[model samples]
Target: MTTQIDRLTTSGWSTCEPIAALVRSRGLPAITREYLLAEFSPETWERAEDATHALAKHFAGARFADEVEYGVLLVPDPHFLDTRRALPTELRGGDVVDERLPAGVALPATRPWQLVVSVIGSYGPSLGSYNEVTASDDFVVLGQDTRQWMTRQVWGARVLQCGATPPDCEHNERWTFTLFPGEELVDGQAESGTVLKGKVRFRLGKPNRGIGSARVAPALLIDVQ
Candidate 1:
């Protein structure tokens, strides 16, 4: 507990919270140790605030506080065909085989990357529930309520990894994960704001929204870009 150097602060700065203090003590984010480990100084703290805004801008998406309500109590007839409800059974141009197109034969194939979401946060009284899905097919059930809860496009998404593959088939094991700015948020669902695009373990502490991704922690960073 003894120091290498005296602490740097006025009575105000010491008693008053540092800019990144909330981010450090609260919420789930992409913040690495490096992000919070810089020397504490007036200039350094100011720079951190700016860095936080930049990180939010480049990596995170806009949040929507639900002003509008979207849901249907009506269940459509199983026999009824709604044009909007139906989509093309298959998508074109998704496979590597397209690179080998011959002069004669044409194959239409588009495979989807598996979309999996591990429940990172919760609503409706503390950390509400834990849900996990391995494929988009299963996601369909939760998509409606989940989308409504998130209330913004891009899923208000915290991108887990860009094009990386999971180390295992399990959604609870991840190869990579990232935290971004505004992760300092203290609302009921800040922990859930995160999206796991690849396999990773997601666990939450009860009665409060707390998500812990299982496995490795990479060299954490905030992309200045």
Candidate 2:
């Protein structure tokens, strides 16, 4: 099977070359990032009218940043600990209609889609008031000229403390989504069968008294309908 990464590599677009490199990197074991990167065309980059403002809006004054280390190393999926969402159909649909549907709930006919990675962190001064901070990839949604996609915030995480730095803490969550078929990125041109893939990394600053911080690394894969 020629994977999404393969198609993107053969596309010969220089913009996707970095994504190819990341796919080739050994440290990361996942391949979803390649799909999103391949979908990112020069046109998409150009259409990002206010890049600075868009990014600022996404960050929302969060003073934390995450660096791409080795590969797109994300925390374990909220449910599976070390597993990622299943590929293909399962990620998008299922037999039963549960109470709360997962992020990438496939829609009927056609619809816009988005994959989001959210990071949340909180700190307390003397264990009383924990100031919360967060950052996420929804900024991409905000930058879009078209507001058609039914977006969802899939993954989130609290900063992981390497050691005993705080008196108390909580486990952060990381999520994944397989969006329905639609044109959220390509815009108007009707990229129905197009799948977009990309990763978002965010970090949060420490609190004043009680230590608090968080980071989220998300790789969102959308179906190229």
lDDT values of the candidates?
0.21, 0.25
- Candidate 2, residues 100-161, lDDT tens digits: the string is 22333222222122222222112211111112111112324343421122122222111121
Best by the lDDT measure: 2
Clashes of 1: 10
lDDT tens string, model 1, 103-159? 211111111111112221121111122221111122122112222222111112111
Among these predictions, the greatest TM-score belongs to 2
TM-score of 1: 0.17
For candidate 1, the 10 contiguous residues with the lowest summed lDDT are 105-114
- Superposed Cα deviation of residue 162, candidate 1 (Å): 4.9
